[model samples]
Target: MTNPLKKYGDARKERIDQLAAMSDGSVAVADAGTIEEAPGVSLIASAWRRLRRNPVFLTGLTITTLFIFLAVFARVIAPHDPAIGYLLDKVRPQSNPIPGPEPGFPLGADNVGRDFFSRLIVGSQQTLIVGVFATLFGLTGGLILGILAGATSGWVDSLVMRAVDVMLSIPSLLLALSISALAPRPSQWTLIIAIATVQVPVFARLLRGTMLQQRSSDHVLAARALGIKRSSIVFRHMVPNALGPVIVQATIVLATSIIDAAALSFLGLGNPDDRQPEWGQMLGQAQQFIYDDPHLAFYPAACIIIVALGFTLMGESLREALDPKSRR
Candidate 1:
């Protein structure tokens, strides 16, 4: 018969070996309770699972993806020069202001006699640039204001919020138009900056609200107790965790950015260069010939509407997916 003490010692050694095999100790924590259980699905991972199953999100993703592909491949895919009226002979006489679809030109001719199809294809690049850059600039501005207010709190938060409120009080479109009108001359950059300025208040307000919640979270409390620097607690801990809602808001803001950029261009505050085609500028130029050729105005208008719709749908679906209350 084996000694009882030796049997107990053997069992204990077996358990230790099993634990050593299972865990490499690669995942570190300041304390054992800091990570009591094994890692599970993260917030972003869980939200993505929901979003993939959402039809609204998929539809928007398809539309947005196709739009981006077109913009990126404009030069490669466009059959004709967007700036050149290469098929002037194909266009009907001055008796007809714009021509309908033909053999090579599917969308026919624009007001200036350029191939409307090529212009539409190429104009996507310009529209994409405006939407992305304006949103990025606005997001950067918002992040700055939000971080300052959310981390500092007290008087800083109040002052920042009040300023944001002042901006919000004015009509958003009107605010954008006022800024665009300030430029010495109309250009794509000017339009982007104007739209970005208008968007800053919305993003700042949303991020600040989210960040404020993170300030009192349990993890933050733990970090403080660990004697981490206040800056590290704010930037390293609080800021990263608080970005989920802000990311969701950015998607919605992208849709608005596109529409606002178009509106600015439509108002003759967009790029003045005829060499570079843009949907909004195309639509603006076509408005004069609406009765003579409604299709010209129709095409660009439809593109803007559809693109904006896609972003809105994606943003809404993503918001629902990320909402803690709706988690599956």
Candidate 2:
């Protein structure tokens, strides 16, 4: 008996070869000037070309770059040891524990007399770690669930979607708060886990929605007709096309993760060690002396706001740039 599948593949391959030969012959015969079209730019390259010209993107890029630089070089940037608080005895007074600017300390000291300037610089490190790791965790989990749901159309999709729906039902903040509160200890890892868990549903839904759209796309149908492996069709053809929105969402989620980490720290569920300074921890401590030393809260709050704004602006600019129909 003739192998039907093999015959079908061979027939398709022959047709493709003939088409390639015809295209080659046509190009050879055509005049150079007849091909008026410019060379095509890839999607990523085009998006980057657009982003380079956008001022909003440049501003956001600058802020985000500065923030990352501060985080990475905090040890070298901070003059004093954040944990030791050398200025403690010098800055502390009986009447007013936290003192204003002194010789060694430019921003003065925290409520506990730790060098506020040094602490603020180090705070960037903690914030970056938490925000980045949490967002990564969420993105990873979401990708897994999205792939599962998108690649298969049956009970598997329903099961994954149901689970995602369950997660989405709960308020994100509340879910994070609950998880943080339930942790055995208040630490950086705990905060990251809580925030990441809350973020999973958002990422999963976005990817899945895009994935479903890709499932019925013409390219996908053609890929199937070409007898490509199921895995290749899902990852190479479908997932890559579906990732644009998810990538934009991930950038915005970075800002949210930082805010959530700060909120958790502010609520006293964050790391208890003063040795490791965090903006939220600073705010929580400053709350006691907010009326007398409002600057304590002001500085850290400003850092948080600026960082969040930078990520949001960058994400928005990226989305606009990546959009095919955008005027830009």
| Local accuracy of candidate 1 as per-residue lDDT tens digits, 1-328 | 9999999999997886677668877643334347467778987898898888989999999999999999999989999999898667656666756767888989888756788899999999999999999999999999999998888968988999999999999998999999999999999999999999998998899888888889889999999999999999998988998888888888999999999988888889999996898888888888888887888889899999999999999998888988887655
Worst 10 residues of 2 by lDDT: 24-33
Identify the candidate with maximal TM-score.
Answer: 2
lDDT of 2 at 62: 93
Number of colliding residue pairs in model 1: 0
Please write out the lDDT profile of model 2 over residues 1-328, one tens digit for every residue. Answer: 9999999999997886777677856653325347567998998898898899999999999999999999999999999999876656665456867878979889888766788999999999999999999999999999998888888989998999999999889988889999998988889899999999998888988899999999999999999999999999999999999999999999999999999999999999988997999999999989988888899999999999999999999999999988776646
After superposition, candidate 2 runs with Cα above 4 Å error: 1-36, 91-93, 325-327
In model 1, the Cα lDDT at residue 192 comes to 92
Models 1 onward score TM values of: 0.86, 0.87
